[model samples]
Target: MARFGSARFTTVQPGVKINNQPRPAPRTRAGGSLVAFAASAVVLLLLLIFILQNGQRTDVHFFGAQGQLPMGVALLLAAVFGVLLVTIQATMRRIIQLRLLTGRRRTPYTSTITRPDPADADPGADVPEGRKS
Candidate 1:
């Protein structure tokens, strides 16, 4: 019977020089932003579906004013107001922190020691005979 495939073998000589060039590094993946955008799009689509499903009209009263509006619109307005309140709170907190940081940095630091002048010394103080004027 004849062999269907022949085996190939490589022989290395003792004096033969081998090529040892280093391979280029693989590139990093840049799909993080794309993934984030897709996730946001999915969330927005779900929010749109929710709004469409709750389109029934309802009466809404705010700070003494009353008006008839769709449930979805009212809910959307409430969400917007809540987001604004949170954003304002965060901004104020950051402002206060920045003010505190800057206040701490503005104060001058001193480690100096002042010496009394010889003219301000006591008139009747005892002095060494060698240093007497």
Candidate 2:
């Protein structure tokens, strides 16, 4: 066995070499940190391009109110509102489910004693030892 920088090189046969290194462990799942960062950067760059391309001012109407704003700003506001609505709805659902679960957990306690059925009792076995059935 040859040691090199916390790695062990073992020769199973005369010529075959196997490297046992702990630095580069096998990945259990796809899309590591670098891949995630690259994907986020791409998305941000696309969004920036979209905003720059749609910089023209436009009139936006909402509930009897009107305002002049950039097209990209209007779209971004709408997207933010949509996300907020969904988050609120999800939070309300989670709260309702939690309340229902808590309510159901408050069950009344039951007695441990149970009455035996008269039909299952053996009448001959209850008689005195000297007496005949």
Candidate 3:
């Protein structure tokens, strides 16, 4: 068997060569980055407003007593969380696409299909003679 790596497959039967090019992939535009940017900006804006109103005295805790962190640190953490969320969504979408490409046979819908059955026919059929029942 000959391997064509990334190239499209072509079949040769007898003296005739047939070019069976693979169908084009579907196009998509992910808004993960845009969402991440928007979320981070909103969080930062809110944090700025909070700092202006509350005078930047935030108590950041981890495992009970990890000491208080500055408001800047807390705002940075919120931005990181937004980025992680976007990354997770993008990763899930890629996994789903890979699964769709590698798994299950696709059966397309058809309006009508021809059936081959002689015994399964109308009993009282109207037709010109010469033709056998």
* lDDT minimum window of 10 residues, candidate 3: 21-30
Q: What TM-score, to 2 decimals, does candidate 3 have?
A: 0.32
Q: What local distance difference test score does each model get?
A: 0.84, 0.84, 0.73
Cα lDDT tens digits for candidate 3, 1-133: 6676957678854543347654454444556677788999998798777756655658877568666656776766767889999999999999999889866666666668889586888654656566846
- What is residue 108's positional error in candidate 3, in angstroms? 16
Error of 3 at 71 (Å): 0.7
TM-score of each: 0.56, 0.54, 0.32
Best by TM-score: 1
- In candidate 3 the C-alpha lDDT for residue 59 amounts to 82
Candidates ranked by TM-score, best first? 1, 2, 3
Error of 2 at 88 (Å): 0.9
Candidate 3 versus truth, CA RMSD in Å, comes to: 18.3
Please list the residue runs of candidate 3 whose C-alpha ends up more than 4 Å from where it truly belongs after superposition: 1-55, 62-66, 105-133
